[model samples]
Target: MFDHIADAVKLPDLVRIGDNLVVARFETMKVYSALAAVEHLLNTGAVQPGDTLMDSSSGTYAYSLALACHKYGMKCHIVCSTKADPSVVTQLELLGATVEQVPIPPGPMVDKMDLEVRLQRINEILAARRDVYWMQQYHNGFHYHGYREVAALIDREMPGAPLTVVGGVGSGASTGGLATYLRELRPDVELVGIQPYESVTFGSEPVEDPVASISGIGSPVYFANVTYELYDRIHWIAHDQAVAATLALYRDHGIFGGMSSGCCYLAAEWEARQNPDRQFLFIGADTGHRYMSSVYTKHDQAVSLTGLEPRGIRELTELELPWAVMDWNRRPYEVAPKVLPC
Candidate 1:
């Protein structure tokens, strides 16, 4: 029934794991956003079918955009992060995408600098080539449009129940887009965002994780598309705990997902236990193959989730290691001034 693999991959499996927990597991979740964005550009004449689409990504978005381009007859060029998986790069190249990785900087604590360099390189490319269109996945509103259909599906499946949607606050589009559309159908939809330590998105910059860059979940750059008002609560997960949760998800439910998925699962499980009256649905953004060596191989080292508990805090200043959660209350917060070099 689907014309392309991209169409088929975008469909998620909604599986109920507990009395109150449901997971919307995706193979590559961002394909929906990329496909919809590309189609819109073509339909509106903003971009022609043969045009080259460019963007900076760590992994999932790169693959997603390449798949979209292959489906729609557009060309894709990705400025990849230093942390991008080798398997992903191979796939992107095979799918006809031109990839250029920003070099890993010298010394420790290179996460923030690497991101800045990627954006700077993107600008250089834009300056040299007028024909190439930058998708600006992090700042573009078009990325949000793709999740409307997903919201409708969730609405129909879990009708008239108090629902809490949880996922990583990556570009802010995934969870933000879902909450935006879901609220239209039924107000009072609670939104929970999972973040990694040291990400500035939720003011966790004060605490730096030595592990640093957990690709696809946290970022060193500021994203314009992350609507601060959409989040009702936020959880900052540490890298070690994420690894444990990732292994646990496979062991417990046979769901092989990435670290971001583990972060969401860990947070959602706790949230579901806290609010038994509300039906909790968490987004599993991608599969675990990309993290086989980085995360899964450390299964023996992973700690038991039974002894772990997040310290609930009233303010961002109280955030600390292992895990922390705060009530954002769907309130808007000012984006901090950018101090990273451009």
Candidate 2:
């Protein structure tokens, strides 16, 4: 019975954004990946039944890990950012997982330093326990393998068309792994990566991104999973741009996706316009229900969509599009593994 619930997590609803754009809304994609990781460890005898599974997540992955532990009768301890959604935190606790919420430092954007602080807390927890296994999402290649099924679904659903896969680059498992698998079948399929304005993923000079209302899409630190070569191009979407696109998606398509989804949607929209014949596919990482308080309820629906007048959907591509564009070959940041204490 629990196995069925675990299995159901992988299948997400695919929705159309426009004529040439589609979003694979992974309302619980992280759950699928997290469960896969834990099961792999258990089956391989890498971890025992009573052992605790630990990791740091912003929100979605924390819920995923907690659910996985609950299904498998294992202990789960999560070190998450204070920015994590309250609803997600409540769910994690209700699932019987212990959570430690680390306070984020005052900054316009979340950066490597913030992640380092979280890592410090996680390390502290790990140091206290001998039977804990860290499902390091950013560096774990196992995380990449879980997404092969996602690529298969995309291929099975949309076969035989020039395709461009686009998504926000977080752990690189979702976007990088999907692109890697898809390319194995169709080498010509284009891969585009999206990040927030302050993210260094595409080598944009780090700045305080006051507008980054979303988490999970952009990283302050360089992660090993984000293979720079896997992408054809990268675009940096601003916080306001993401917010505008997110609200527009809800109003126009009735798709209530998170900010990262909006960022990918905006990029996919641009890519679709550039190549009308090709299908632009992007990942809707999660739903916006968790963001209702800060994102939806706080803003005026009418003004949120129309306030950015000159920079509205009409000028999305021309003006409000990528703050910076980088070809994969010419990216500024060195793609190397971050040396962490964990």
Candidate 3:
């Protein structure tokens, strides 16, 4: 019975963009990882049937966890951000998960502050409910293990080639986990992590009450699982760049992917131009359906596509792009986890 949802997480389609680049479209990648993590807990007896599963998510992970809990006959509770798509919240309820939506933080949409408040609220819920088991996606090692197969699948598909894996850095499970496994197979593999402009992940100067338009990637606070050593380079993509790329992707490739995926695509394109000899693989985190209201619908379609044109893409690098880029090795802050009250 567990295999029903567990089996669905394998082998996202690999779509070739041109000669040197490919986008690995994992339509439900987070859902797949969530199922894998939950199955591990169940199989190892870490969690028993009917235990309530609790976690905090911006949006994608909440839906994934809700689906996993539903499949396994467990009750689910989520501390979700108010930024989450209304559709996702509705679906979570439909799947029978209880939800607590945290209001967006005052001042700005600083993801770190928003996340910190969400985590604090999550702990408050956990403190009151001794029976619930927190999935702890941000701190859980099991979350990292779930994406090992994604790395293996990519390695199997492209053998003996120097590869650059590019993707948005979120909880760090998806990109961090994939890089961890891939590096085991090919030590020479390059990793490029992308985050939003104001994200603390890449050591960018903090904006005063900055609001982030993109979700599911970038954090105002550091996640314990985001392995800094695995990255060869890191790039920060801004809201406008992400939006422009997203519109371009839909117009050019017919791929309806979200802002994070757009960020990955733009990074991949830049990397591909730089290393024409190497194969660049970008992980498309999720589809664009959830972004219609926030991203697609709000923009003038023709204007958005036009904004992407003048960048003279082939000549652009991290410096020329709308966002900033930094070598991860030079980051001033230590990538260690901060002690938090659980």
Candidate 4:
């Protein structure tokens, strides 16, 4: 039995979608990251009980950190993006976490600007409050520790299997952390990262998705925690395609997951079809409840999943809209000049 709701929520439900494709689904995947990070901080005396843990989030990490703080008698303060769902903000407040929504700026780069504003606010908060500890989910190495247990679970579940992990690369903790530990057991394990159009994380910044930033998956800013070398391939998906895949996922497989899950599903399904001999695993980062109004309600605009496929390209400059994939070959890109230890 789990000791707390955070413990219960952090565990993923491994569900097989196809004969070779499996999805490690979570209520809020970052609970694992936040729990481990908080525990480590407390043990190391970086933070004490009742000290406020602050972080910037679109939604998922905010909820996870709040739950982690609630479980350990710590306080949580969230500097949220304008894109953060109203439902999530409500939950954060109810959980006793202080919330501040960054103002939506006027421009084409709203997503990027929102993140910059949030980070700026965080800097200001850190300067003023000595008791407030910035969680720095995007840069903290402690965030990666929790996923080692997940890797162990996968190793036990799929012993001696040739695995290709496909998932969204957000702060990079979930996909990067999982692959880092999984590689220790199977050196040949492949990791395919999914990103939304316009996310600078994997060189899709040139192109813009009309409906941009799929919550927790892609980022407008560079994440130090994202170990670029961990990815063997990267796929960029547009908003419409993710919506279609999300709708089809529930209609066909009954897994009601978020936008990141939808994007990962598309990549995983395609990869599974291409390499029938290999096993494919994708991550369902969170449930679709938060995306109901923003994504699910626009089901009429969603396209069919059958005809959809990623256009394979050799260079990052050749990135196109809707969907695209590149063979990253487990090499770090120039954008991430200094590789952070995994």
Candidate 5:
């Protein structure tokens, strides 16, 4: 008697942002948008319910997967680093999912099966369970170009303004696929690939110590999606600068966001200042509420994500942060493409 709930990314309104000035209103569409796309991919006569989903992430998406699993009563085995935000973890548990904590230190090389290996390890864990649906955002070439839908909408909404898109990645799907789509629509567009100070797997890498500030993007190793074919230029953001920028946005604009989002937002600000005629556009992957112990919160609280990444610095706020939580920007992230398993 009622309409069934479909995926999140497919809805026309969900794919585009209506507001330009206020961020909160604009971000509402992102969760459903990403989910819709992911679900559509699954519905392609391939995936089904009751299959275990193995997703590894250091941020909010892992939790989102847990909730998505609830709809089909699928088992969710999430791989998270010691460095992963606590709020992300809490939500997964609430959805009756399991979280495996990575144990290790940086750089010695994490075995894809090592608990500390995060997504790489989740790939291994699900290997033993044939019924497990391992969804890697990487190998799946069928990118919905969710960003393109948003970008075109933004361009149309704000005419006479140049659109500059910037962000970092490990899966590199957003950077590559979105760039390809936007360039087709607006050849003069500038798609900026933001990398951390260290891991420049693609593009002309910046000169800096280690170079990568974000763990997922700028990986020391080349990821499946981060190919050379996808970008106009590369911009590097310092870890501290991204942290500072995120804090500044929270203080000034009251926009609580994650690291990659922070990088894109700062780059957008720089673009807006450089080309006043352009209306800068960027992606906000998730809310910063998940990051209470780190850059998203106070300053100087201690926490661990895993050995492959740095330990988090705690914020000094007296607020008791939950180990994990979920809000709007939550969605699934795959290290590889999400394809169906028999």
Candidate 6:
């Protein structure tokens, strides 16, 4: 395993969605490192088969978990931020799961907040009165084990192949866990992590082409698992490049995906040109339709695109994690308490 990582390398494990289209196709789901870990947990009695599932999401993770819970006869109680699209909330509820939209985050991305921060203060308030389970994506000192199973899957499906893995980060579960597995299987393989320039970190830098628009990969919470030691290189994709990739996937391969996946593919293509013989795998986190109101429309892109307003370049390290903040609401709640349960 150590032999392959000679040049700032990573273990390759990329989970993909079929067609990578803007339209959502629940039926064509495929688990990469995360799902593989989740499935194994289910099989080994590590993850108990329960009557319910609870987790926070932006959109794609919620849908993925909701579908998984439903298949296993488990009800899903999703506590999502207000930024998640309404269609996603409606879909989960219609699928027999209860949806709780968390209000009062200062911005569009609330999941980025740390569990130790002020928003978590509100969460404690809700959990105090409610009966829902707190599905801590990470347990103890371990990154989410969901990526472990994904690693096993990669080992079986792709043996001895030099892979270029690309995807976003959230709980750092997918990034840390999968990287762990890939390194174990083939130490020489490279693992490349991706992030938006607007929210840069260890593996990223800001791009001036467009403003950040995608979701699911970047976060305020830093995981112990996604270490500099585990990664080969971190690349920053501009929001415009991401959008162009999304449109290209739709126009060329007929895959309609969010700008985030476009970032992944853009990275993949970049890697491929550098190593044409190597197989590059990428995670298509979600469809673009969820972003139709944002990246898909021309007027939306024009008004909000990078060139329009022109935000300056940022280092991934400079962007703040939402939880890095000390308070959730310094001012009084304008809308009286909604009396939400956990």
List the candidates' TM-scores in order: 0.97, 0.87, 0.87, 0.95, 0.69, 0.66
Who wins the lDDT comparison? 1
The global Cα lDDT (0 to 1) of model 6 is 0.52
Better of 4 and 5 by lDDT: 4
| Candidate 5 per-residue C-alpha lDDT over 195-311 given as tens digits, one digit per residue, 9 for 90 to 100 | 664343532122344323465456544456665545655555566666666676666666667766666666656555556665556666666665566675554432322221221
- Candidate 1's residue-wise lDDT over 1-342, tens digit each? 999999999999999999999999999999989999999999999998889999988788999999999999999999987668888899999999999999967875587777778889999999999779999998889999999989999999987669999999989889999999999999979999999887777888779876655667767667888899999999999888899999988899999999999999999999999999999999999999988988898888877788788999999989999899999998887657864522
- Pairs with backbone N, CA or C atoms under 3 Å apart (clashes), candidate 3: 112-220, 112-221, 256-288
Candidate 2 per-residue C-alpha lDDT over 1-342 given as tens digits, one digit per residue, 9 for 90 to 100: 535565776678888768888988877778767877888888989999978999988688888888889888999998887767777788888889988888878874355656888998877877887988988988887777777788888888887678998888888888877888888878778888887755555544334566442468766666777777788777776777677788877777888888888878777777788799898898888889877876777557423434232222221133333354555642335733543322
If both were scored by lDDT, which would come out higher, candidate 4 or candidate 6? 4
Q: How does residue 60 of candidate 4 score in lDDT?
A: 84
lDDT of 3 at 199: 53
Total clashing pairs for each candidate: 0, 1, 3, 0, 45, 22
How would you order the candidates by lDDT, starting with the best?
A: 1, 4, 3, 2, 5, 6
On a 0 to 100 scale, what is the lDDT of residue 305 in model 1? 82
Task: Score residue 119 of candidate 5 by CA lDDT.
Answer: 51
Highest TM-score: give the candidate number. Answer: 1
Give stretches of model 6 more than 4 Å off.
1-52, 105-118, 125-131, 138-144, 152-161, 200-210, 299-342
- Compared with the true structure, all predictions reach lDDT values of 0.89, 0.75, 0.76, 0.87, 0.53, 0.52
Model 5: per-residue Cα lDDT at residue 342 = 12
The digit string of per-residue lDDT tens for model 3 on 242-262 reads 887887788789888988888
**What is the C-alpha RMSD, rounded to one decimal, of candidate 1?**
1.4
Model 5 off-target regions past 4 Å? Answer: 1-37, 71-73, 105-116, 143-145, 203-212, 296-342
Lowest summed lDDT window (length 10), candidate 3? 309-318
